[model samples]
Target: MSARMQVRLWLWQRISAALLAPLVLIHLGTIIYAVHAGLSAAAILGRLHGNLWFGGFYALFVLACAVHAPIGVAKMAEEWLGWRGARVTSLAAVFALLLLAGGLRAVYGVVLS
Candidate 1:
């Protein structure tokens, strides 16, 4: 990859990390609240169902994750695993696709269906 592309990916990873930090906190807090409130599965689903805001939030979260994890993994591979060049990037691409596919499916099930 070109140096410019690598820099772009680095910037994206940082941006995504910044976005995800607050989101993760909110997500965990919500989980805690739901568990404390003894919210049943049906109740949780009811809350999420047809909620555009919830869907959008999760979609953003998933997108950020898709962008973030692969870059981090690629960096890890380069640093710790002594892997680099196309192989590392190819694996990151695959990981990103899997994350997107699964995360979007989950978003569909919980918020759209």
Candidate 2:
């Protein structure tokens, strides 16, 4: 990647990290509270389903994950797998697709089911 691209990716990763922090905390806190309260799957699903705010939050969370993971993986591959340039870019693209697919699937299960 060029210097400009690297800077952009770094900025994006930082932004995504900032977005993820609160979402992750909220998710973890909800899970812990729900488990402590003995909330059933159906009860949790009830809160998630038909809730636009929750849906939007999960969507944003998924998008951030999609952006964050590939960039991190690209750096990992460069260090560990000796990948760079086009190869790293292609791998990151595949990683992004997989992240999007899995993340959105989770969001759908949470929000739609």
Candidate 3:
């Protein structure tokens, strides 16, 4: 990647990390609160049952995961697999799509279905 592209990606990664920090903390705290409140799976599902707020939050989380993981994997591939250039980026793109598909599937299950 060009230096400018690398810088943009670096900036994106940092922004995502900044956004994710509170989200993850809130997610964990929500889980803890739910369990402490004695919410059963059915009860929790009822709360998320067709709710847009939870759905949007989860979708955002999945999107971030999709963006974040491949960058990490791309760096790993560069270091460990000695892969770079077009091949590495292509692989990372594939990895990102895989994450998207799987994550969105889960998100759909929780949100719409």
Candidate 4:
């Protein structure tokens, strides 16, 4: 990638990580509360289904993950695997797509089911 593109990617990764930190905390907290309450799948689904706030939260979370993970992976490939150039970009694109599709699928299953 070009120097400018690399800088943009780095900035985006940082921004996405900042966004994800709180969302992940909230997610984990919700899981802990659900487990503590012994909430059934149906009960959890009841809370999520048709809730716009939950849907939005999860959608943003998924988007952040899609953006964040690929950048990290690309960096790792460059640093650890000694891979670079078009190959890394191609892999990152595929990884981002997979994350987006799977995460959105999960959001749909839980929030829109």
Each model's lDDT: 0.95, 0.91, 0.88, 0.95
Model 1 pairs in collision: none
Best by the lDDT measure: 4
How big is the positional error of residue 14 in model 1, measured in Å on the Cα after superposition?
A: 0.8
Top candidate by TM-score:
4
Tens digits of per-residue lDDT for model 4, 74-109:
999999999989999999999999999999999998
RMSD of each: 1.2, 1.3, 1.2, 1.1
The C-alpha stretches of model 4 lying farther than 4 A from their native spots are none
Off by over 4 Å in 3: none
Q: How close is candidate 3 to the true structure, as a TM-score?
A: 0.92
Candidate 4 similarity to native, TM-score:
0.94
Cα lDDT tens digits for candidate 2, 14-76: 999999999999989989999999999999888788887888888898999999989999999
User: For model 1, how does the per-residue alpha-carbon lDDT over 1-113 read when each residue is reduced to its tens digit?
Assistant: 68998899989999999999999999999999999999999999999999999999999999999999999999898899999788998989999999999999999999988
Cα lDDT tens digits for candidate 3, 3-84: 9988887887787788778889989999999999999999998899799998889888888888887888888998998997
What ranking emerges by lDDT with the best candidate at the front?
4, 1, 2, 3
* Model 2 TM-score (2 dp): 0.91
